[model samples]
Target: MTSFPQIDAVYETHLPVRDLDRAVEFYHDTLGLELAYRQEARGMAFFWIGGQQTGMLGLWQAGSAPMRMVLHMAFRLGQEAVLAVPAELKAKGAEPLGFEGEPVREPVVIGWMPALTVYCKDPDGHSIEFLCPLPDAPDPDFGIGPWSRWLQR
Candidate 1:
Protein backbone atom coordinates (compact mmCIF):
# COMPACT_ATOMS: atom_id res chain seq x y z
CA MET A 1 0.00 0.00 0.00
CA THR A 2 1.26 3.47 -0.87
CA SER A 3 1.19 6.08 1.90
CA PHE A 4 0.32 9.67 1.15
CA PRO A 5 2.64 12.39 2.35
CA GLN A 6 1.62 14.15 5.56
CA ILE A 7 -0.08 17.47 5.07
CA ASP A 8 0.50 20.24 7.58
CA ALA A 9 -2.19 22.91 7.36
CA VAL A 10 -4.05 25.03 4.86
CA TYR A 11 -1.82 27.65 3.27
CA GLU A 12 -4.46 29.61 1.44
CA THR A 13 -8.03 29.74 0.09
CA HIS A 14 -9.44 31.58 -2.91
CA LEU A 15 -12.90 33.15 -2.91
CA PRO A 16 -14.99 34.53 -5.74
CA VAL A 17 -16.34 38.04 -5.35
CA ARG A 18 -18.46 40.15 -7.62
CA ASP A 19 -16.34 43.24 -7.09
CA LEU A 20 -12.73 43.01 -6.22
CA ASP A 21 -12.53 46.54 -4.81
CA ARG A 22 -15.51 46.03 -2.51
CA ALA A 23 -14.10 42.74 -1.34
CA VAL A 24 -10.79 44.42 -0.69
CA GLU A 25 -12.45 47.15 1.37
CA PHE A 26 -14.32 44.66 3.52
CA TYR A 27 -11.35 42.37 4.04
CA HIS A 28 -8.74 45.06 4.43
CA ASP A 29 -10.71 47.85 6.08
CA THR A 30 -13.51 46.20 7.97
CA LEU A 31 -11.98 42.84 8.79
CA GLY A 32 -8.56 44.45 9.43
CA LEU A 33 -6.67 42.12 7.10
CA GLU A 34 -3.51 43.55 5.60
CA LEU A 35 -3.69 44.15 1.88
CA ALA A 36 -1.00 42.01 0.36
CA TYR A 37 -1.31 43.17 -3.23
CA ARG A 38 -3.74 43.30 -6.12
CA GLN A 39 -3.70 42.45 -9.80
CA GLU A 40 -5.97 44.97 -11.46
CA ALA A 41 -5.79 43.39 -14.89
CA ARG A 42 -6.77 40.04 -13.46
CA GLY A 43 -9.44 41.54 -11.19
CA MET A 44 -8.02 39.87 -8.13
CA ALA A 45 -6.70 40.87 -4.69
CA PHE A 46 -4.85 39.12 -1.95
CA PHE A 47 -5.01 39.69 1.81
CA TRP A 48 -2.81 38.51 4.60
CA ILE A 49 -4.85 36.45 7.02
CA GLY A 50 -2.72 36.00 10.15
CA GLY A 51 0.50 37.85 9.62
CA GLN A 52 2.58 39.04 6.72
CA GLN A 53 3.53 35.95 4.70
CA THR A 54 1.86 33.59 7.18
CA GLY A 55 -1.47 32.96 5.46
CA MET A 56 -3.12 34.28 2.33
CA LEU A 57 -6.63 34.63 0.91
CA GLY A 58 -7.20 35.49 -2.72
CA LEU A 59 -10.33 37.23 -3.91
CA TRP A 60 -11.08 36.85 -7.60
CA GLN A 61 -13.72 38.87 -9.35
CA ALA A 62 -16.59 36.76 -10.65
CA GLY A 63 -18.00 38.82 -13.53
CA SER A 64 -21.70 38.22 -13.06
CA ALA A 65 -22.92 34.91 -11.72
CA PRO A 66 -22.92 34.58 -7.94
CA MET A 67 -20.68 32.19 -6.12
CA ARG A 68 -21.67 28.59 -6.78
CA MET A 69 -21.43 27.69 -3.10
CA VAL A 70 -21.36 29.97 -0.08
CA LEU A 71 -18.05 29.27 1.62
CA HIS A 72 -17.41 29.17 5.35
CA MET A 73 -14.01 30.42 6.49
CA ALA A 74 -12.92 30.29 10.11
CA PHE A 75 -10.11 32.30 11.65
CA ARG A 76 -8.47 31.48 14.93
CA LEU A 77 -8.07 34.31 17.40
CA GLY A 78 -7.17 34.99 20.99
CA GLN A 79 -9.89 33.95 23.44
CA GLU A 80 -10.89 37.45 24.43
CA ALA A 81 -10.77 38.65 20.86
CA VAL A 82 -13.02 35.81 19.76
CA LEU A 83 -15.49 36.78 22.48
CA ALA A 84 -15.47 40.37 21.26
CA VAL A 85 -16.31 39.67 17.63
CA PRO A 86 -20.05 40.26 17.85
CA ALA A 87 -19.78 43.79 19.19
CA GLU A 88 -16.79 44.56 17.01
CA LEU A 89 -18.60 43.58 13.84
CA LYS A 90 -21.65 45.56 14.91
CA ALA A 91 -19.52 48.63 15.53
CA LYS A 92 -18.32 48.32 11.96
CA GLY A 93 -21.91 48.12 10.63
CA ALA A 94 -21.97 44.35 10.14
CA GLU A 95 -24.34 41.90 11.71
CA PRO A 96 -22.91 39.01 13.62
CA LEU A 97 -24.76 35.75 12.96
CA GLY A 98 -24.94 32.40 14.62
CA PHE A 99 -24.62 29.05 12.89
CA GLU A 100 -28.37 29.11 12.39
CA GLY A 101 -28.19 32.54 10.68
CA GLU A 102 -29.76 34.24 13.64
CA PRO A 103 -28.33 37.40 15.24
CA VAL A 104 -25.54 36.44 17.57
CA ARG A 105 -26.18 37.92 21.00
CA GLU A 106 -23.06 36.25 22.34
CA PRO A 107 -20.38 33.80 21.37
CA VAL A 108 -21.44 30.17 20.89
CA VAL A 109 -19.52 27.15 22.04
CA ILE A 110 -19.32 24.23 19.69
CA GLY A 111 -18.77 21.37 22.11
CA TRP A 112 -17.56 18.96 19.48
CA MET A 113 -14.83 21.29 18.39
CA PRO A 114 -14.84 22.75 21.91
CA ALA A 115 -14.33 26.15 20.41
CA LEU A 116 -15.98 29.46 21.11
CA THR A 117 -17.17 30.86 17.82
CA VAL A 118 -19.00 33.79 16.31
CA TYR A 119 -20.21 34.09 12.73
CA CYS A 120 -20.82 36.82 10.21
CA LYS A 121 -21.19 37.31 6.47
CA ASP A 122 -18.90 39.14 4.09
CA PRO A 123 -20.12 41.64 1.53
CA ASP A 124 -20.52 38.77 -0.97
CA GLY A 125 -22.53 36.65 1.50
CA HIS A 126 -19.72 34.29 2.38
CA SER A 127 -19.88 33.07 5.96
CA ILE A 128 -16.94 33.93 8.19
CA GLU A 129 -16.16 32.58 11.63
CA PHE A 130 -13.92 33.80 14.45
CA LEU A 131 -13.07 31.09 16.94
CA CYS A 132 -10.90 30.11 19.89
CA PRO A 133 -10.74 26.78 21.60
CA LEU A 134 -11.79 26.56 25.21
CA PRO A 135 -9.18 25.47 27.66
CA ASP A 136 -10.14 22.10 29.16
CA ALA A 137 -13.34 22.01 27.21
CA PRO A 138 -15.61 19.13 28.07
CA ASP A 139 -15.69 15.96 26.00
CA PRO A 140 -17.35 16.50 22.64
CA ASP A 141 -21.12 16.72 22.92
CA PHE A 142 -23.65 19.03 21.39
CA GLY A 143 -23.36 22.39 23.12
CA ILE A 144 -24.19 25.96 22.17
CA GLY A 145 -24.91 28.97 24.33
CA PRO A 146 -24.09 32.56 25.07
CA TRP A 147 -20.54 33.08 26.32
CA SER A 148 -21.62 34.20 29.77
CA ARG A 149 -23.95 31.27 30.13
CA TRP A 150 -21.51 28.77 28.68
CA LEU A 151 -18.76 29.95 30.98
CA GLN A 152 -20.93 29.59 34.02
CA ARG A 153 -21.55 25.92 33.29
Candidate 2:
Protein backbone atom coordinates (compact mmCIF):
# COMPACT_ATOMS: atom_id res chain seq x y z
CA MET A 1 0.00 0.00 0.00
CA THR A 2 1.10 3.55 -0.64
CA SER A 3 0.99 6.29 1.96
CA PHE A 4 0.29 9.98 1.47
CA PRO A 5 2.54 12.70 2.87
CA GLN A 6 1.42 14.24 6.11
CA ILE A 7 -0.26 17.55 5.59
CA ASP A 8 1.30 20.52 7.34
CA ALA A 9 0.64 24.18 6.67
CA VAL A 10 -1.39 24.94 3.52
CA TYR A 11 -2.28 27.92 1.36
CA GLU A 12 -0.09 30.32 -0.54
CA THR A 13 -0.48 33.61 1.38
CA HIS A 14 -2.67 36.29 2.95
CA LEU A 15 -2.75 39.84 1.61
CA PRO A 16 -3.62 42.71 3.94
CA VAL A 17 -5.99 45.38 2.79
CA ARG A 18 -7.94 48.35 4.16
CA ASP A 19 -11.26 47.75 2.39
CA LEU A 20 -12.94 44.39 2.01
CA ASP A 21 -15.12 45.58 -0.82
CA ARG A 22 -12.19 46.88 -2.85
CA ALA A 23 -10.26 43.69 -2.36
CA VAL A 24 -13.25 41.65 -3.33
CA GLU A 25 -13.72 43.73 -6.44
CA PHE A 26 -10.12 43.34 -7.52
CA TYR A 27 -9.80 39.68 -6.64
CA HIS A 28 -13.29 38.50 -7.38
CA ASP A 29 -14.77 40.83 -9.98
CA THR A 30 -11.53 41.75 -11.66
CA LEU A 31 -9.58 38.53 -11.22
CA GLY A 32 -12.59 36.18 -11.29
CA LEU A 33 -11.85 34.41 -8.01
CA GLU A 34 -14.91 33.57 -5.96
CA LEU A 35 -15.32 35.44 -2.68
CA ALA A 36 -15.58 32.78 -0.02
CA TYR A 37 -15.93 34.58 3.29
CA ARG A 38 -15.85 37.92 4.99
CA GLN A 39 -15.17 38.39 8.69
CA GLU A 40 -16.07 41.77 10.10
CA ALA A 41 -14.61 41.16 13.53
CA ARG A 42 -11.35 39.95 12.08
CA GLY A 43 -11.55 42.64 9.41
CA MET A 44 -10.72 40.15 6.73
CA ALA A 45 -12.08 38.58 3.54
CA PHE A 46 -11.23 35.31 1.83
CA PHE A 47 -11.30 34.37 -1.86
CA TRP A 48 -12.29 30.90 -3.06
CA ILE A 49 -9.47 28.86 -4.68
CA GLY A 50 -8.48 25.22 -4.84
CA GLY A 51 -5.23 23.24 -4.15
CA GLN A 52 -5.33 23.79 -0.40
CA GLN A 53 -7.57 24.95 2.38
CA THR A 54 -7.56 28.74 2.54
CA GLY A 55 -5.05 29.29 -0.26
CA MET A 56 -6.91 32.45 -1.17
CA LEU A 57 -6.35 36.03 0.11
CA GLY A 58 -7.04 38.09 3.23
CA LEU A 59 -8.21 41.67 3.52
CA TRP A 60 -7.30 43.66 6.63
CA GLN A 61 -8.56 47.11 7.58
CA ALA A 62 -5.37 48.30 9.18
CA GLY A 63 -2.73 50.92 8.52
CA SER A 64 -3.20 53.86 6.16
CA ALA A 65 -5.44 53.77 3.10
CA PRO A 66 -4.33 51.60 0.21
CA MET A 67 -0.75 52.64 -0.24
CA ARG A 68 1.51 51.22 -2.94
CA MET A 69 1.61 47.56 -1.99
CA VAL A 70 5.20 46.50 -2.82
CA LEU A 71 4.41 42.81 -2.45
CA HIS A 72 3.67 40.41 -5.33
CA MET A 73 1.27 37.47 -5.52
CA ALA A 74 0.55 34.75 -8.06
CA PHE A 75 -2.14 32.12 -8.61
CA ARG A 76 -2.27 28.96 -10.69
CA LEU A 77 -4.57 28.40 -13.67
CA GLY A 78 -4.30 25.44 -15.96
CA GLN A 79 -3.87 25.79 -19.76
CA GLU A 80 -7.53 26.12 -20.69
CA ALA A 81 -8.27 27.92 -17.45
CA VAL A 82 -5.66 30.57 -18.30
CA LEU A 83 -8.00 32.28 -20.70
CA ALA A 84 -10.34 35.14 -19.82
CA VAL A 85 -8.20 36.56 -16.96
CA PRO A 86 -6.64 39.49 -18.80
CA ALA A 87 -9.85 40.21 -20.66
CA GLU A 88 -11.73 40.25 -17.39
CA LEU A 89 -9.20 42.65 -15.90
CA LYS A 90 -9.35 44.94 -18.92
CA ALA A 91 -13.12 44.82 -18.97
CA LYS A 92 -13.06 45.89 -15.32
CA GLY A 93 -10.75 48.88 -16.18
CA ALA A 94 -7.38 47.49 -15.12
CA GLU A 95 -4.63 47.63 -17.72
CA PRO A 96 -2.27 44.73 -18.22
CA LEU A 97 1.13 46.41 -18.18
CA GLY A 98 2.96 43.48 -19.78
CA PHE A 99 2.95 39.71 -19.92
CA GLU A 100 5.26 36.74 -20.50
CA GLY A 101 4.24 36.39 -24.14
CA GLU A 102 3.41 38.39 -27.29
CA PRO A 103 1.97 41.84 -28.22
CA VAL A 104 -1.07 41.51 -25.97
CA ARG A 105 -3.07 38.64 -24.58
CA GLU A 106 -0.47 36.19 -25.86
CA PRO A 107 0.26 33.88 -22.97
CA VAL A 108 4.00 33.70 -22.35
CA VAL A 109 5.38 30.25 -22.39
CA ILE A 110 8.59 30.14 -20.39
CA GLY A 111 10.59 27.15 -21.50
CA TRP A 112 11.96 26.51 -18.06
CA MET A 113 8.84 27.27 -16.09
CA PRO A 114 5.53 25.47 -15.78
CA ALA A 115 3.13 28.36 -16.33
CA LEU A 116 1.72 30.48 -19.09
CA THR A 117 1.75 33.72 -17.06
CA VAL A 118 0.15 37.10 -17.52
CA TYR A 119 1.07 40.08 -15.36
CA CYS A 120 -1.11 42.88 -14.10
CA LYS A 121 -1.20 45.46 -11.33
CA ASP A 122 -3.98 45.53 -8.82
CA PRO A 123 -5.73 48.73 -7.76
CA ASP A 124 -3.19 49.06 -4.94
CA GLY A 125 -0.21 48.84 -7.34
CA HIS A 126 0.73 45.39 -6.11
CA SER A 127 1.75 42.95 -8.83
CA ILE A 128 -0.27 39.79 -9.33
CA GLU A 129 -0.24 37.02 -11.92
CA PHE A 130 -2.52 34.27 -13.18
CA LEU A 131 -0.37 31.23 -13.95
CA CYS A 132 -1.45 27.93 -15.47
CA PRO A 133 0.99 25.13 -14.95
CA LEU A 134 2.89 23.94 -18.08
CA PRO A 135 3.66 20.47 -16.85
CA ASP A 136 5.53 19.59 -20.03
CA ALA A 137 8.05 22.38 -19.65
CA PRO A 138 11.52 21.69 -18.35
CA ASP A 139 11.84 21.92 -14.59
CA PRO A 140 13.63 25.07 -13.58
CA ASP A 141 15.56 26.04 -10.46
CA PHE A 142 12.92 28.00 -8.58
CA GLY A 143 15.02 28.18 -5.40
CA ILE A 144 17.99 30.12 -6.77
CA GLY A 145 16.13 33.17 -7.99
CA PRO A 146 14.95 36.27 -6.16
CA TRP A 147 11.38 36.31 -4.96
CA SER A 148 10.07 38.09 -8.05
CA ARG A 149 12.39 36.22 -10.39
CA TRP A 150 10.66 32.97 -9.63
CA LEU A 151 7.57 34.33 -11.33
CA GLN A 152 9.46 34.80 -14.58
CA ARG A 153 10.67 31.20 -14.65
Candidate 3:
Protein backbone atom coordinates (compact mmCIF):
# COMPACT_ATOMS: atom_id res chain seq x y z
CA MET A 1 0.00 0.00 0.00
CA THR A 2 1.24 3.47 -0.80
CA SER A 3 1.99 5.40 2.36
CA PHE A 4 0.04 8.63 2.44
CA PRO A 5 0.60 11.51 4.81
CA GLN A 6 -1.62 11.23 7.86
CA ILE A 7 -4.46 13.70 7.91
CA ASP A 8 -4.27 16.54 10.38
CA ALA A 9 -7.10 19.10 10.47
CA VAL A 10 -9.62 20.47 8.02
CA TYR A 11 -8.19 23.59 6.43
CA GLU A 12 -11.31 24.71 4.64
CA THR A 13 -14.82 23.94 3.41
CA HIS A 14 -17.23 25.59 1.04
CA LEU A 15 -20.94 26.28 1.16
CA PRO A 16 -23.26 27.34 -1.62
CA VAL A 17 -25.42 30.37 -0.97
CA ARG A 18 -28.22 32.11 -2.74
CA ASP A 19 -26.57 35.43 -2.13
CA LEU A 20 -22.88 35.82 -1.54
CA ASP A 21 -23.30 39.25 0.03
CA ARG A 22 -25.84 38.09 2.62
CA ALA A 23 -23.82 35.01 3.47
CA VAL A 24 -20.72 37.14 3.83
CA GLU A 25 -22.53 39.49 6.18
CA PHE A 26 -23.82 36.62 8.31
CA TYR A 27 -20.44 34.90 8.53
CA HIS A 28 -18.42 38.09 8.98
CA ASP A 29 -20.69 40.46 10.92
CA THR A 30 -22.80 37.94 12.78
CA LEU A 31 -20.56 34.94 13.27
CA GLY A 32 -17.45 37.12 13.50
CA LEU A 33 -15.22 35.07 11.18
CA GLU A 34 -12.55 37.34 9.80
CA LEU A 35 -12.99 38.21 6.14
CA ALA A 36 -10.02 36.76 4.31
CA TYR A 37 -10.57 37.41 0.64
CA ARG A 38 -13.26 37.86 -1.94
CA GLN A 39 -13.51 37.37 -5.70
CA GLU A 40 -16.34 39.46 -7.06
CA ALA A 41 -15.92 38.11 -10.56
CA ARG A 42 -16.50 34.57 -9.33
CA GLY A 43 -19.14 35.59 -6.80
CA MET A 44 -17.13 33.99 -4.05
CA ALA A 45 -15.95 35.08 -0.62
CA PHE A 46 -13.56 33.42 1.81
CA PHE A 47 -13.30 33.87 5.57
CA TRP A 48 -10.68 32.84 8.03
CA ILE A 49 -12.04 30.42 10.60
CA GLY A 50 -10.32 30.19 13.97
CA GLY A 51 -7.42 32.20 12.54
CA GLN A 52 -5.65 33.15 9.35
CA GLN A 53 -3.51 30.03 9.03
CA THR A 54 -5.69 27.54 10.91
CA GLY A 55 -8.84 27.27 8.82
CA MET A 56 -10.75 28.87 6.02
CA LEU A 57 -14.39 28.83 4.92
CA GLY A 58 -15.49 29.60 1.40
CA LEU A 59 -18.89 30.90 0.41
CA TRP A 60 -19.86 30.46 -3.23
CA GLN A 61 -22.85 32.01 -4.90
CA ALA A 62 -25.43 29.58 -6.25
CA GLY A 63 -26.81 31.27 -9.27
CA SER A 64 -30.44 31.37 -10.40
CA ALA A 65 -32.42 28.13 -10.24
CA PRO A 66 -29.70 26.41 -8.29
CA MET A 67 -30.53 23.09 -6.68
CA ARG A 68 -30.59 23.29 -2.89
CA MET A 69 -28.52 21.38 -0.38
CA VAL A 70 -28.11 21.38 3.40
CA LEU A 71 -24.56 21.07 4.67
CA HIS A 72 -23.11 20.85 8.18
CA MET A 73 -19.92 22.30 9.60
CA ALA A 74 -18.69 23.09 13.09
CA PHE A 75 -16.34 25.53 14.76
CA ARG A 76 -14.49 24.74 17.96
CA LEU A 77 -14.73 27.29 20.72
CA GLY A 78 -13.84 27.50 24.37
CA GLN A 79 -16.23 26.00 26.91
CA GLU A 80 -17.54 29.31 28.21
CA ALA A 81 -18.35 30.57 24.73
CA VAL A 82 -20.17 27.36 23.82
CA LEU A 83 -22.33 27.84 26.91
CA ALA A 84 -23.25 31.34 25.88
CA VAL A 85 -24.17 30.64 22.26
CA PRO A 86 -27.87 30.13 22.81
CA ALA A 87 -28.37 33.56 24.28
CA GLU A 88 -25.97 35.34 21.95
CA LEU A 89 -27.56 33.83 18.87
CA LYS A 90 -30.99 34.61 20.19
CA ALA A 91 -30.02 38.21 20.70
CA LYS A 92 -29.04 38.33 17.05
CA GLY A 93 -32.43 36.87 16.00
CA ALA A 94 -30.93 33.49 15.17
CA GLU A 95 -32.40 30.33 16.65
CA PRO A 96 -30.14 28.11 18.71
CA LEU A 97 -30.73 24.38 18.21
CA GLY A 98 -30.27 21.21 20.14
CA PHE A 99 -29.04 17.95 18.66
CA GLU A 100 -32.51 17.18 17.43
CA GLY A 101 -32.64 20.43 15.45
CA GLU A 102 -35.30 22.03 17.63
CA PRO A 103 -35.05 25.39 19.33
CA VAL A 104 -33.02 25.02 22.49
CA ARG A 105 -32.72 27.04 25.66
CA GLU A 106 -29.09 25.98 26.12
CA PRO A 107 -26.32 23.93 24.64
CA VAL A 108 -26.52 20.12 24.75
CA VAL A 109 -23.84 17.63 25.61
CA ILE A 110 -23.46 14.72 23.26
CA GLY A 111 -22.28 12.22 25.83
CA TRP A 112 -20.59 9.82 23.44
CA MET A 113 -18.21 12.57 22.43
CA PRO A 114 -18.77 14.38 25.71
CA ALA A 115 -18.80 17.63 23.83
CA LEU A 116 -20.90 20.67 24.61
CA THR A 117 -22.41 22.01 21.42
CA VAL A 118 -25.13 24.18 20.01
CA TYR A 119 -26.36 24.57 16.47
CA CYS A 120 -27.69 27.36 14.31
CA LYS A 121 -28.58 27.77 10.67
CA ASP A 122 -27.20 30.11 8.10
CA PRO A 123 -29.56 32.06 5.86
CA ASP A 124 -29.24 29.19 3.39
CA GLY A 125 -30.16 26.60 6.05
CA HIS A 126 -26.74 25.04 6.38
CA SER A 127 -26.10 23.73 9.88
CA ILE A 128 -23.48 25.68 11.81
CA GLU A 129 -22.23 24.35 15.12
CA PHE A 130 -20.15 25.81 17.92
CA LEU A 131 -18.59 23.28 20.23
CA CYS A 132 -16.01 22.48 22.85
CA PRO A 133 -14.97 19.03 23.98
CA LEU A 134 -15.66 18.30 27.63
CA PRO A 135 -13.08 17.27 30.18
CA ASP A 136 -15.27 14.42 31.31
CA ALA A 137 -14.77 10.86 30.10
CA PRO A 138 -16.84 9.65 27.20
CA ASP A 139 -20.16 8.15 28.21
CA PRO A 140 -21.62 6.50 25.16
CA ASP A 141 -24.40 5.06 27.32
CA PHE A 142 -25.60 8.54 28.12
CA GLY A 143 -26.30 9.26 24.44
CA ILE A 144 -27.17 12.98 24.30
CA GLY A 145 -28.85 15.25 26.82
CA PRO A 146 -28.98 18.66 28.42
CA TRP A 147 -25.75 20.45 29.31
CA SER A 148 -26.81 20.96 32.92
CA ARG A 149 -27.35 17.24 33.40
CA TRP A 150 -23.87 16.47 32.13
CA LEU A 151 -22.40 18.69 34.81
CA GLN A 152 -24.23 16.88 37.60
CA ARG A 153 -22.98 13.50 36.45
Candidate 4:
Protein backbone atom coordinates (compact mmCIF):
# COMPACT_ATOMS: atom_id res chain seq x y z
CA MET A 1 0.00 0.00 0.00
CA THR A 2 1.18 3.51 -0.69
CA SER A 3 1.97 5.68 2.33
CA PHE A 4 -0.54 8.46 2.94
CA PRO A 5 0.66 11.95 2.18
CA GLN A 6 1.19 14.06 5.28
CA ILE A 7 -0.90 17.20 5.15
CA ASP A 8 0.90 19.98 7.00
CA ALA A 9 -1.31 23.07 7.21
CA VAL A 10 -3.83 24.99 5.19
CA TYR A 11 -2.03 26.36 2.17
CA GLU A 12 -4.88 28.58 1.02
CA THR A 13 -8.60 29.28 1.25
CA HIS A 14 -10.86 31.10 -1.17
CA LEU A 15 -13.66 33.49 -0.31
CA PRO A 16 -16.33 34.95 -2.55
CA VAL A 17 -16.93 38.65 -2.12
CA ARG A 18 -19.38 41.07 -3.70
CA ASP A 19 -16.61 43.56 -4.39
CA LEU A 20 -12.98 42.68 -4.97
CA ASP A 21 -11.67 46.20 -4.33
CA ARG A 22 -13.48 46.48 -1.03
CA ALA A 23 -12.30 43.03 0.01
CA VAL A 24 -8.73 44.00 -0.91
CA GLU A 25 -8.99 47.16 1.18
CA PHE A 26 -10.31 45.20 4.15
CA TYR A 27 -7.73 42.44 3.99
CA HIS A 28 -4.73 44.42 2.79
CA ASP A 29 -5.42 47.84 4.31
CA THR A 30 -7.59 47.38 7.38
CA LEU A 31 -6.33 43.97 8.53
CA GLY A 32 -2.79 44.75 7.36
CA LEU A 33 -2.36 41.57 5.34
CA GLU A 34 0.28 41.47 2.63
CA LEU A 35 -1.25 41.62 -0.83
CA ALA A 36 0.28 38.77 -2.77
CA TYR A 37 -1.25 39.32 -6.17
CA ARG A 38 -4.18 40.61 -8.18
CA GLN A 39 -5.55 39.12 -11.38
CA GLU A 40 -7.81 41.73 -12.91
CA ALA A 41 -8.79 39.47 -15.76
CA ARG A 42 -9.82 36.77 -13.32
CA GLY A 43 -11.62 39.21 -11.04
CA MET A 44 -9.67 38.07 -8.02
CA ALA A 45 -7.11 39.23 -5.43
CA PHE A 46 -4.87 37.23 -3.13
CA PHE A 47 -3.33 38.11 0.25
CA TRP A 48 -0.59 36.46 2.23
CA ILE A 49 -1.96 35.28 5.53
CA GLY A 50 1.32 35.20 7.40
CA GLY A 51 4.02 35.97 4.89
CA GLN A 52 4.86 35.75 1.21
CA GLN A 53 4.95 31.96 1.18
CA THR A 54 3.30 30.72 4.36
CA GLY A 55 -0.41 30.86 3.53
CA MET A 56 -2.71 32.58 1.08
CA LEU A 57 -6.29 33.91 1.09
CA GLY A 58 -8.01 34.46 -2.22
CA LEU A 59 -10.96 36.76 -2.73
CA TRP A 60 -13.03 36.23 -5.88
CA GLN A 61 -15.49 38.72 -7.31
CA ALA A 62 -18.77 36.82 -6.96
CA GLY A 63 -21.13 39.59 -8.14
CA SER A 64 -23.99 39.97 -5.66
CA ALA A 65 -24.41 39.44 -1.89
CA PRO A 66 -27.18 36.91 -2.37
CA MET A 67 -24.86 34.70 -4.36
CA ARG A 68 -21.98 34.88 -1.86
CA MET A 69 -21.78 32.72 1.25
CA VAL A 70 -20.80 33.94 4.69
CA LEU A 71 -17.68 32.15 5.86
CA HIS A 72 -15.30 32.21 8.82
CA MET A 73 -11.53 32.09 8.90
CA ALA A 74 -8.98 32.52 11.67
CA PHE A 75 -5.60 34.21 11.60
CA ARG A 76 -3.07 32.99 14.15
CA LEU A 77 -1.00 35.58 16.00
CA GLY A 78 1.15 35.89 19.07
CA GLN A 79 -0.43 36.33 22.49
CA GLU A 80 0.19 40.05 22.63
CA ALA A 81 -0.86 40.64 19.06
CA VAL A 82 -4.06 38.67 19.52
CA LEU A 83 -4.91 40.71 22.61
CA ALA A 84 -4.40 43.97 20.77
CA VAL A 85 -6.35 43.06 17.64
CA PRO A 86 -9.71 44.11 19.11
CA ALA A 87 -8.59 47.65 19.89
CA GLU A 88 -6.91 48.10 16.55
CA LEU A 89 -9.95 46.75 14.71
CA LYS A 90 -12.20 49.08 16.67
CA ALA A 91 -10.04 52.08 15.78
CA LYS A 92 -10.48 51.09 12.15
CA GLY A 93 -14.28 51.25 12.72
CA ALA A 94 -14.73 47.48 12.92
CA GLU A 95 -16.60 45.90 15.78
CA PRO A 96 -14.77 43.27 17.80
CA LEU A 97 -17.30 40.49 18.44
CA GLY A 98 -17.68 37.63 20.86
CA PHE A 99 -18.87 34.07 20.24
CA GLU A 100 -22.46 35.28 20.19
CA GLY A 101 -21.59 38.10 17.77
CA GLU A 102 -21.99 40.71 20.49
CA PRO A 103 -19.43 43.53 20.85
CA VAL A 104 -16.66 42.54 23.23
CA ARG A 105 -13.89 44.52 24.89
CA GLU A 106 -11.64 41.50 25.37
CA PRO A 107 -10.75 38.26 23.70
CA VAL A 108 -12.52 34.98 24.49
CA VAL A 109 -11.17 31.57 25.44
CA ILE A 110 -12.63 28.36 24.12
CA GLY A 111 -12.10 26.05 27.11
CA TRP A 112 -11.64 22.86 25.13
CA MET A 113 -8.75 24.15 23.06
CA PRO A 114 -8.14 26.93 25.54
CA ALA A 115 -7.27 29.24 22.71
CA LEU A 116 -7.70 32.98 22.98
CA THR A 117 -9.76 34.48 20.20
CA VAL A 118 -11.64 37.55 19.03
CA TYR A 119 -13.79 38.02 15.95
CA CYS A 120 -14.72 40.73 13.48
CA LYS A 121 -16.73 40.77 10.28
CA ASP A 122 -15.52 41.83 6.87
CA PRO A 123 -17.47 44.32 4.75
CA ASP A 124 -18.97 41.40 2.89
CA GLY A 125 -20.12 39.81 6.18
CA HIS A 126 -17.56 37.02 6.43
CA SER A 127 -16.37 36.45 9.98
CA ILE A 128 -12.65 36.99 10.55
CA GLU A 129 -10.92 35.77 13.70
CA PHE A 130 -7.68 36.57 15.46
CA LEU A 131 -6.47 33.73 17.66
CA CYS A 132 -3.65 32.40 19.88
CA PRO A 133 -3.21 29.24 21.89
CA LEU A 134 -3.02 29.65 25.61
CA PRO A 135 -0.05 28.38 27.59
CA ASP A 136 -2.29 27.14 30.36
CA ALA A 137 -3.90 23.75 30.69
CA PRO A 138 -7.34 23.05 29.26
CA ASP A 139 -10.42 23.18 31.48
CA PRO A 140 -13.50 21.87 29.76
CA ASP A 141 -15.66 22.88 32.69
CA PHE A 142 -15.02 26.51 31.97
CA GLY A 143 -16.85 26.06 28.67
CA ILE A 144 -16.21 29.37 26.82
CA GLY A 145 -15.95 32.89 28.13
CA PRO A 146 -13.90 36.11 28.18
CA TRP A 147 -10.09 36.10 28.40
CA SER A 148 -10.28 37.64 31.88
CA ARG A 149 -12.28 34.66 33.12
CA TRP A 150 -9.77 32.33 31.56
CA LEU A 151 -6.95 34.16 33.32
CA GLN A 152 -8.73 33.77 36.63
CA ARG A 153 -8.65 30.00 36.22
List model 3 lDDT by residue over 37-131, tens digit each. Answer: 99999999999987887999999998656567889999999999999999999988889999989999989999999899999999999999999
Candidates sorted by lDDT, best first? 3, 4, 1, 2
Candidate 2 structure quality by residue, lDDT tens digits, 47-90: 76772365767666556654545567777776665556667666
lDDT score for residue 141 of model 3: 85
C-alpha RMSD by candidate, in order: 1.8, 6.8, 1.4, 1.4
Model 3: residue 74 alpha-carbon error in angstroms? 0.7
| Candidate with the larger lDDT of 1 and 4 | 4
Q: Which candidate leads the pack in lDDT?
A: 3
Candidate 1 lDDT over residue span 1-153, tens digit each: 999999866778889988788889999878999888899999999888887656899999986653366788888898999888999999988899887888987888887668888999998889999989888657454566667766676
Q: Estimate each model's TM-score.
A: 0.90, 0.67, 0.94, 0.93
Q: Tell me which residue pairs clash in candidate 3.
A: none
Off by over 4 Å in 1: 1-5, 139-142
Worst 10 residues of 3 by lDDT: 61-70
